[model samples]
Target: MKKMVYASLLFIFFSTLFSLADTTVLKPSKEEEIRDTIVVHGMVLHGRVTGIGPQRLSFKLRYSDGTNRIAYKDIDSIYTKYNYRISFKRMDIEGRIVGIEENKQYLKILEGNHERTVKIADIDNFIMAVSEDDSFENVVRNKFPYTKGSIHAGLEVENGINRKNTADVRLNLKRKVAEHETRFFLNYNFETTQTADEPKVQNKDELIAAATYKNYFENEQFFFASLAAEYDRPRQIQQRWLPSVGYGYKFTFDKAFWLEPAVGLAYATTQYTDIQYQDDQFTAAALRLSGEYLMDDVIYINTLIIDGNIMYYPSLTAAEEDWIMRSNLGFSIPLFDFLSVKFIIDYTNDSNPDPEVGNNKTTSSLLFGFDF
Candidate 1:
């Protein structure tokens, strides 16, 4: 029976579908056999989802060489676990029912463009947004690349009585394919301070850049790899590099709010330029809690956004002073079409610092810049 089903699926899809170019999927690191059956143009097919959009569905058969599109007009029914779409109408249909609307007199099931009006309570079967396909190149080429939340950049500067004169800049970018996403971030900051007791002034510079890649599964579970490099002058750190791999889970409360908990193992190396502690290298584990919240035109005038990042490392042995902590909080608002204001607090704590330096460092900046 299994052989017969597999053969029928092969015959149905291979005879009609065409290969999608500029798309490639990585072979799975672990073998977990699975398939989905799609009903289109009176033909039944078994395959995996490659991409999905407002009106178009795409897939490829099991053991097939390439993926192809399932024109919305030709599709009769869809059955999958991840990206399910149910047909509901005066004709008939229903689902697990995660939502409902009292005023609008309708319910929203499925995500994206495939939603339909129940003229009455109805449902057919199911369709899915995607299946277990993890190919970075394919995702970057397909519908995933052009979706929402791909790029952001900003800068901030400040001079005040309570804080030193300072400047900070940050940039973030991401590329995605289906459930997989890759992100890059760059940050640089400089500060000058003049204290009443100290005769001379002091200045510091910090530069950090990082790259991370993640693969997502159901229930917001994901696995990831990261690489980062940094330079901190006050701590007499000439250069530092860290490479890590780990996993994380995302929490979505609504369209504008979400949080992620992440953990990773890292190998770190640091070179000190001016301080007594010359060079240090070690291995440590990393933990992170990150979240974002956005409010559109709050107070009926300006949009408001807030984001935060916190990271921690704990000591594991008697010989290692590995405890470390870092956190960042930012608030941004747009005043006009091409202008904005931002405030940020950045803090770091290291268990071990050069004897000439303090164990804690804090920077606060309020800046204005042009938006793109």
Candidate 2:
């Protein structure tokens, strides 16, 4: 009987040991993991990923060699080190929604093994959450808008300074806040011509400055306004100021072409150098049409931008003294990255001009300036 009891006890002990061993046996981990191995154009780079953008991948080696750059195209493949923080028992049901069956009260998505019957109304956000791997450009354009300014300098070498001394100066600047835009423009022309009797006579002197503000809508309609000030020595005008408020509609067929039609009322103030009329002020109705065309793909030209605007002020007075029409044609040619040559034509027609000044005036300028 003692032998039987000892044998039974031994059997029990072996069974308990086998149970412990079975419980201790470990299976492969459930988490999905990968090692860091990035191959770029047949080159192997080993480092922790600091940044991954659409244009390049940034990483640092074991030693401080600074951040390295690898072209996205040169990257043959990528092996990321997946250090997951949590592991679930079942496969995740993570995916985008395709649709929902209202009758069955089930949400149909592109992924998931479980029954997805979540209500769409319960979702708080519409757009997908921004991932940590988004590109820099993408973030700048979408999440947070940024401002960049550049200055360009250009020149003309047609005639030497001794023969024809001419210089064109131009400037352009713009600022944006959400849908609102404000722009500033300035152009000046100075020329000295040499004659038989006169040496380097100052012939042309002109200046134009303008500031415009516009609030745009999603549907392309906009409320616009402008304030313009100008001066011309030859035209016998000491100063001219024009302020207008208007509405405009933008027609955009493509990225290369767009037009805006606008109408408003303008108050014009002119202080003339002519002895007959020293100052004059009037209010008139104004109509404007402006457009832009981009020709940057031309082989010989680095960039060619053509823009034009026409402003017509009809007679608002019975005497027809306030009628005026002004227009402009401009060209911007970029020779290099931050350098460009600008050509502009300014024309004005005033029905009631100063005594010595004619009824029409046309001025053209070639300017070189730097943008920074």
Candidate 3:
């Protein structure tokens, strides 16, 4: 009897130890397998969300090539791996998010064995609760080359009393990964006009490409580099290049607004189409101011967005009259999900200009575009 009792006790002890070991090993493996799932455009994807914009969400996809962004309104649904703390106008709920449903009007959550549904309009915001090992910063740091961009285009043609054709295209792109951020810009325009009896004349032909890069630090300070290339047949400029390097500080008033002001050294060179005007090169002190304001909700007709920048280059090596300035302002309203309607104005001033051309030029356009 004593031997049997001892055998039973040893069996229970070893069984408990094995059970504990199994639990320990299984917990971490389950967590590691968890992945967020997103449905957009009838395609399902597994990924980690790196960041959120006012209009889009940046995702680092698994079993895919690289990071890209999708507009929130275009997302069919989202299933999260971790628990989320959802904040409403009056209360908060903690649960594992099942998905957004009912055309994005409601969010479904799983709380233990029970499920709950909440209206999205009544909810203010929600955020995932990440574990220490899977912090938000760590997720973003691992996803390099997260990018978003848009293309805007416009075309117009007229016939009958007058014949005219115009085409305009603009591209804006931004990328942020880890501590580095970059922006790219391009614009092209072409127009030809003719009266009933007059010959066809080229009214405008222009192209511009610009890029900027920044490396951020912990203190909201950054070092930046910029380059721009441009040509305009109407203005008699064959080619122009501007390059600059600067330091800047970013000021954030809120999630919806921020500003950056910078000062740097710049070098510019220009070649004119007219042989009478000589090619020129000069150096300058570059000054730049840029900012953005994005509405969280529909403050106006739609979520209004305003962004603009100004750059001034005052000559240091050339004559005082060789200074240059460029400025642009844009106002946009979101349409159907990822689409936007924008009105943009661009201005340029050059103290030294080609013969028969004015010192200042301004252009404006209305454009329709979609984000990608």
Candidate 4:
């Protein structure tokens, strides 16, 4: 009996060793293997639907390609996970998928006319189905480019102690030269003012022609420069011709907030019909600093802005030599992609004493304008 028990123990130990060796040598089945090769046709399974159009549907299809893994535009009539049947006008296109989140799907087509990726997850009926057509890659390559023009019209009101109370009608036209980077702007502003000491003021107009260049620079730094020529016709004073150069720089934080610092210089000369006040030539320099926080793509909340300017009269006689300083504080809000409305308070002071008029005045204005 002792020899039999010893023989049984030896048999059990060898059996266990043999079983371990067999388990170590086992291989995976065909269905469990990963595939790397591209596969043209496979039955659609569980995947996300990313885009929908009037005549098209776009989604991603995941499947194994015999050797590893592959993904492509599944533009086929495949059943969605929810059980509705869907079809595409195209299929098997290559594109990047962007913005994928829980219960959300987005895909971008890198090729053809529809280069933009779209998001679609709200369609209720078509959960699972299959249909096919062209590929998204071919469609995105054929989009066309075009230009657009627009007009702005608004009313402005201003009141001041030493200056006249004014009401104005404003009109402007702008055309886009390049999608969002460059533009041509033309402005015509006309105002009428009334003062207690002066005669009724009428026909104050400023005509401005300007061209602007924009740079989408590095590190969220954006720069813009413009050259402008203007004719200012005042009912009470001589008409003036001014040429100005200005540049602005803005540093953006994330996509929503930015700080802009700007400077400008202007050379102006007046033409007189009566010469009651000497026709003079002057140089004006201006500085502006502002900060804007974007609430959204279309809305901006102004945090702060300070604008200051100095005017030097170079052609005046010794007795009439004078300088003027002006400063403004304002906030602007955009109403549309191209239109904005502003509220501003301005203060002005002159160095020369005019016995009839005070040296300082405060004014308020409401302005509406547009950008191309």
Q: Where in model 3 is the C-alpha error above 4 Å?
A: 1-51, 54-145
lDDT accuracy of residue 2 in candidate 4:
100
**Which lDDT tens digits does candidate 1 get at residues 164-248?**
6666777666655446678887777776775555543547688878888888866589998888888887677788877878889
Residue 308 miss distance in model 3 (angstroms):
0.3
Model 1 misplacement above 4 A: 1-166, 192-202, 300-302, 318-320, 336-339, 370-372
**What's the CA error at residue 49 for candidate 4, in Å?**
18
- By summed lDDT, the worst window of 10 consecutive residues in model 4 runs over 138-147
| Best first by TM-score, ranked | 3, 2, 1, 4
Q: Which residue pairs clash within candidate 2?
A: 150-371, 150-372, 151-370, 151-371, 151-372, 152-369, 152-370, 152-371, 168-367
lDDT, model 1, position 118: 40
Best by TM-score: 3
**So what's the TM-score on candidate 3?**
0.65
Best by lDDT: 3
247: Cα error in model 1, Å: 1.0
Taking all chains together, the TM-score of candidate 4 against the true structure is: 0.40
lDDT of 3 by residue, 1-372 (tens): 999999999999999999999998777556557778889988998866544454456566876655566666778888877665555544556566677667555768886678888765444444454442367643442232245678998899999879999998999988664467899999999999999899999989999999999988666799999999999888888999999999999887754688999999999999988888889888999899999998644644536789999999988966467887889999988664457898999998886565478888888999999865
Weakest ten-residue segment in model 3 by summed lDDT: 137-146
lDDT of 4 by residue, 283-314 (tens): 66634455655332222342222333232222
